[model samples]
Target chain A: MSAKPPASIDALIELLAKLPGLGPRSARRAVLHLVARRSQLLHPLAEAMTEVAATARECLNCGNIATGDLCPICLDDRRATGQICVVEDVADLWAMERGGAFGGRYHVLGGTLSALDAVGPEDLGLPRLADRIETEQVTEVILALGATVDGQTTAHYISDMLDGRTRVTSLAKGVPVGGELDYLDDGTIAAALAARTRL
Target chain B: MSAKPPASIDALIELLAKLPGLGPRSARRAVLHLVARRSQLLHPLAEAMTEVAATARECLNCGNIATGDLCPICLDDRRATGQICVVEDVADLWAMERGGAFGGRYHVLGGTLSALDAVGPEDLGLPRLADRIETEQVTEVILALGATVDGQTTAHYISDMLDGRTRVTSLAKGVPVGGELDYLDDGTIAAALAARTRL
Candidate 1:
């Protein structure tokens, strides 16, 4: 609006605009929606935010978000399968969890080693990962990082770093589970063909 | 994640997903962002939301949101131009304010008369609007509702109801200020030609 809204409402809109996928226009709409449905949406959301702000914390063991020192997965005794899946971020770890196939624990690297950004292995908890292999009796490590150059570089570096200590494996290079061959990119098609499996 | 997050965090994401533009995926991303930047974004946002949730209220006179009984526009002596702008929702009022064109007070209808939804004049505060026209000594009433059929029907209903009480006006129909002629629909082209003004 040409006229600025009340200070509190304006502040809410500005903060909402900073969210990842929401811009100024959508943020304004969101603010209006919240204001219109105050009891049902806005007030409850505010309470939830306050609660989460006070309690949410990062897991000390694997970098996953938790309400306590260690994440739930790391705390579970049954999940101590002598294997660790390494990912670039907590979001990636969550994606892997959604697949429901991995029985081992996860190590969130926080980010990949970015040469341009000056991010190194140390910045991504690689050192901590090494410590976990021995401490947690990990016998295998799965690299579930992206297919980007940095991801590959990070994977190779970790493999070399842990050489002769544990079995290192990676997600297969193939078409996605529900992917149609015609819709795939050239690199994906080539990779799928190169890594074709026997029936 | 396969494992549920802490209850508070899960609740926050669910509430965020109910917003206008955000879906479950984006809500998760937004929550992750807030958690990652707790001090900078999350805490401040939560505080702002709490403040707005406590103070924000509907204007008794015009149905616009305000922190007090009367909205800022209704309280301002400078905006007493004896002209009232009628809009379907508070969002439209804010949009008009952003344009900085109108100099009169606003009357938010909250919604239009929707027969399918069993909405009627009283449902949209039309009676209160009529009372305001007489009490505020309004000279002109501008209908700035949408171009949809319901919006037009609402505008016509209001105009007829106030036929003798005040002068009535609708926004002009023409190509938008910067709109290209070729890209416009045929109806818009016809309206623009029919309402053409002398150069």
Candidate 2:
């Protein structure tokens, strides 16, 4: 038999390969899985995908995903805690959520202010965030940005913008939570130990 | 803030969490990613999912996946090479495909017959396979089954049913597959070497 896959299957595989962490091999496997489990898995997944395709939208206010204009977190009355955790992207927000420590809503910046990429405050949704701070009566803004240079720069700029009106703090740096001490590099260990001023 | 997700989102996550290799954490991250890229990734994925959900089917003959009555492999005239590589599952078939060695169609058994779990030949689709052997003029049957007891037992049963009418072979055993050999145990290494034969 010819080694090439059918055009429809090949298209499906190509699209699947574009997903994060899904290479051509993995995409092929996943596509086959979808096919094998067509009734119980593939069909349902397709339906859900279609439904999400049509209804999925970003939360205009906080940049979180939502089926409607606002995401569930933004819509919940209980989440109106007047404190917003600012993140560089939804991934960071998810990382924070996985910690299950924070109890306030979030503000996704979409991306950082990158000089290399020519990304700026406008692209990062700083203006919308400011407006949210005022309308939502936000009293504190927690900066949960990454430790990269651009992440730091974005944090500083946001901190300055909300200096007096809203209290500002950033995610603690030092030891990565789920990491073991043995895996830490000397530089990281030194930085963590050095930053151990007070709890 | 409220700890619970919205009803619809929560329902979606629950279902997503059940996908192979996905935990609640990964499911949440995936949903977030889909939402973030709604217009590009999310929308397209959803549409694909929907179409598949509606039209996806399983091959009645080989237990493989199909968008129609039979999977493309089963339908292609060129693939009717009178050979069917029997596998314990779709994943194994996929693994073989990745190796790019086999050039014939496949028969996904869905699972090996398990007596501990009370599985019988009927449960594993041996009846349909027996019928396929004669109807499809199958000349050689390759048993690419797992090394587990159930996998071996299934292979023996299949070979017996063929009654020496067709050639039967099994994938050579010994090497630790899908992983580096460096991580294999001494017993596994010895077994692999002992089973080695001239090609």
Candidate 3:
């Protein structure tokens, strides 16, 4: 079989396949489509990919992606609402933003504290989160974590860590068990954040 | 609401959203995931993407993506089997290869001849294909286009153009109506190729 694609094209297909929901089959299709639409899609995408690859980095303060040391939300002083919304991942923070309801800053935890996975507060930047609560003069900490056991455990730990110092709230309603924040619609995220209940 | 993401991250999201099957929501999630998995997934993917973006180009002869002017398949003298598989796009050719069934080289037509879209034989590379047939001593031309109206029309036109000079066949059976080769399973594609009858 004259099946071996060029090394560069093969590399792209392999990388694309690693993305969520894209297996080898879909990746091959996507790469082919990009090649066919080279001028409109492939070239632009490749250029953008190169640019982003060179510039993208994590915001030092918020764990959000940034071109510089701080993400936009973290840098903007006007975003300080004395409320820092804590999330299991950056996707959750983006979901909160898509709701257009949150006015404060975000603290992406990278992932929930998981005993099975050997993930702890340190791994999730909980110490840094506590420092933010004190330094940023945060009055509230809203937990927008997944509804899984590890998520709840992590939320409880954070609440206890900040006990008596600030209000700790969890998004109420809409989120189901094992439901990822990225899967929630904007309306759902908005409603849940608005109806947040003290943990 | 102070919901806007950083400019560079937002740009990445916008580009990712344009990918096939990835909407805005999924794109954001995907970007976030990449950021979190930077060392393991993101860094490598970014490097690979950058390298490919810089080096990749279309094979002048067959439209397959390559690092050089001509694709490896087209450059290989041993692959000159006097048979060229004519696919509507490069993805179809890739699909055939993934099945490890085809032994001949490929000619990506870029798209099927479609009058509705103001496309004709020239747009689908029929002129170059004819040249390849004559110059390469191609005795057979396998049509691996979709089962759509344009696919059939283009196949008929190519057969007429070659008229009695070479055997014309298509990847047959198991391909549903309007089904693209990229979507089919490897087993199904193999079966289709094996059962392919003369067109």
Best by TM-score: 1
DockQ leader: 1
lDDT of 1 by residue, B1-199 (tens): 2576778888999999999899999999999999999999999999999999999999999999899999899999889899999999988998899899999998999989999999999999999999998899999999999888999999999999999999999998889989999999998899889999999
Each prediction's RMSD to truth: 1.6, 4.6, 6.5
Give the CA lDDT, 0 to 100, for residue A108 in model 2: 90
Q: Measured by TM-score, how close is model 2 to the native structure?
A: 0.77
Can you tell me the CAPRI class of model 1?
A: medium
Superposed on the true chain A, the predicted chain A of model 3 yields a TM-score of 0.84
Clashes of each: 3, 6, 0
lDDT of 1 by residue, A30-108 (tens): 9999999999999999999998899888899999999989889988888999999999888888888888888889999
Residue-level lDDT tens digits of model 2 in A42-126: 7666666666667767788888767788987888888788889998776676667767888789999988898889998899889
By TM-score, the candidates rank as 1, 3, 2
How big is the positional error of residue B56 in model 1, measured in Å on the Cα after superposition? 0.8
Taking candidate 2, what TM-score does its chain B reach relative to the real chain B?
A: 0.85
Tens-place lDDT digits, model 2, residues B1-199: 3345444566666666655556777777777766667787877776666666566566777766566888777877878889899998766765787787887888888888888888899888888888888898999999999877888899999989877778988887676558678988787788888987789
Query: Which 10 residues in a row give candidate 1 chain B its minimum summed lDDT?
Result: B1-10
The Cα local distance difference test for each model comes to: 0.92, 0.77, 0.81
